[model samples]
Structure formats: C-alpha cells, structure tokens
Target: MEYCDGGSVVDLMEKRGFSTLRIGEAVAIILQVLEGLTYTHNAEIPNVRLADGSFAKGRGLIHRDLKPGNIFLANVGGKQVAKIGDYGLAKAFDQAGLSGQTMTGNVVGTPYFMPRQQVVNYKYTQPDVDVWAAAACLYVMITGYSPRNLQDQDPFLAVLQNDAVPVRDRTSAIPQPLATVIDRALIDNPDIYYKSAAEFKQALFNSIS
Candidate 1:
C-alpha cells in the first residue's frame, strides 16, 4: 500500500498540483479508489475485499472507518493521490440482514462523512453509506477541507438529514455539473446515488464533456 502512497485526501488538497506527477496521474489515483470500492460494494460480500484487495474477499458488513490519521498521502511524481487505509473497523456483515431488521450496525462510520440514516436509523444499507462517504471524501480532496458541521456532533449527518445545503453551497466555485453529481451522491437516498462505482465514475466523466 505504501507504494501507492499519498497522504490523506485532506493533505493532498492542501498541496494540490504539488505532486511530481501530472494532473492526469492524480485523477487516475482517484479513479483507482472508485474502481476498488465499486467492486467491494457491488460484487464482493461484506468484509471480502480490501479497498485495495490485499486480503481475500470478505463477508458481512464493512464499516469503513475513515479518518485523517489513518489515511496516507505521498508525492506520486507531480501528482498527489488519496489512498484509503486502516481497516480496524472493517468487519464482516455476519448477521442476516443485520439482525433481520436493521441493515447496519449502530456504531459505524466517521462523523464527517457518514449519512444521517446510519446514525439515526438502523436500516441503512452499506452501499448507500459508502456512496455518501465517497462523495464526502471527494469533497474534502477538492476543497482541502472536511465538510464537517463543527456546531453539531456529526455535520455530515446534519447535511444528510436537512438536505438543505448542497455540496455546491459549501463551495461556490464548484462547477454546476460536478456539484450536482456530488449533491446526489451525498444525499440520504440510495436510489439516487450512483448504483456502482463505475456509474459514479461515468457520471463524473460525462459531466466534464
């Protein structure tokens, strides 16, 4: 994983364009994370595959504990990339439909990027939660700041619940199409969120053209 090293998305944003690689290379790394998560969410069973597939495909639920310290950042030529790390909270979804009722565990995900349903509702699904986190992470990488509501315990949850502020509101400079893409991704609705990592990537690519 160190070979694919780059600091946390936060660090990368602070020093964007500082990498030794070109922008295309940086985009490739971001796409890498997309492809990796896509496989885990769509095909691999919970706890099956690592974000980068170091271990065997897993079963059960994957909490995906994301944090600043856990993630790494390094200079990739002239590009900086965000690498997923630390699977301490990564667990197998062993239960049947999460105890035949709730779709996920009560204690899951980081405050800044987790959806509200995960925190407030017991029936949230893993795919939706991951989508929200992915969008949030992308936001941090692009803006160089975590979309946290310091006033609340979990700002990401706040965003999910209210559905009032779009990602664009937080950063006015964001292009309309890109902002819309992220807005749909971060919301609490799985139906609207990209069905798979590939779909999400395509939408991003489509928006540019």
Candidate 2:
C-alpha cells in the first residue's frame, strides 16, 4: 500500500479543533471519496492474474466500513488527495446474485457512520452502505458532529433507533441543495436512496453545479 503522509480525515478534524471545514475543502474530500467508491463498488471480484495468463469473471464489492478515520489524505502533485482505506470489513457480492451473506450474525463498523441496514446485517451489506457512510463523513466535516446523536445513548442502539440528523438542522450555513444531497444519502434504506457511489456522486455534482 502507498503511504498517505497527510494522515486521515479524522486527524485533519482534530487538528482544526473539531471545527467545520470550509465548504470547498469538505466537498473536495467527499468528491474524491465518492470517485474511489465508484471504482471500488464496480471492481471485478477475484481480480487476479492466473498462471495461464487468464482471469476470472467477478462481481461488485461492498465496503462495509467507511468513516473519516478510514479516509486518508496524501500529497499528490502538490495537492492533498483523499483515498479510501481499511477494507477489513469489505465483502464481495456473489456472481450469481447481488444478495448473499458473507457471514452470519456479525455486527462490525463504526456506529457513528453506519446506517440502520448495516447495523442489522453487516455480513449481507451492499454498496449503498458505503455511500451512507461517505455522507456521514461529509456531515461531520461540515457540522463538527455525527449525523446521529451519540451522547448518552448506546451507540449501536442509536444507530438502529434514530434517523440521521439533517445537515441543515445542524448548521443552516449549508446551502439547501447541498444539504438535500447529503441528507438523502444518509437515509437508512439503501434500496430507496443512492444505491451506488456513482449515483451519489452524480447527485452531489448536480447539487453543486
């Protein structure tokens, strides 16, 4: 793996004293992450070179864990670039069907960035879970707080019982169109929201452009 000398997004947040970043910085980071996710979600499974100089057909991958801590920054051509990291919880979908459990009865992921569906079943999670988490990361960067309240309640329970706090509710400084895009991405139901990173990225572009 290439080294990311600039550190993770969480490090940047901490360095800024947990204050929100400028709109441009936050959007730039998120756009980079979304681009990475677009590629990752559509990556070919079992993407390995065979001894006979052949390859096998495959399916998409689901990155079950995505948060500011997992997004690293690197200095590339004098510009800081955001890159997705830590795929310990990533799972590949089956070639036969998009739905298949990689494991059973396992709950893994940062509660602050996870959606309800991921909390319910991490093993059978889909790509949209990553999109939700990406939005959560953006939300934190813009609001200095997680989308869900994490104060006095059990984190896991809060994930299951609470809806994501609207981006504008945390701070009205966010433009309505941008807020709408981020808020929609954090919706608990992946089937109804951005089903892939490409979709989420397009929505973001449309909102800003």
Best by TM-score: 2
lDDT of 2 by residue, 53-160 (tens): 464565666778899889999999999999999886777654322223333566878899889888886656778888989999999999998999978999999988
lDDT digits (tens) for residues 9-44 of candidate 1 = 455545756322232433355566666566555444
RMSD of each: 6.6, 4.4
What are the Cα lDDT values of the candidates? Answer: 0.55, 0.83
Regions of model 1 farther than 4 Å from truth: 1-5, 14-29, 42-63, 67-82, 93-105, 121-124, 144-160, 189-192
**Considering only N, C-alpha and C atoms within 3 Å, which residue pairs clash in candidate 2?**
none
**At residue 189, what lDDT does model 1 achieve?**
47
Indicate the residue-level lDDT of 195 in model 2. 84
**TM-scores, in order shown?**
0.66, 0.88
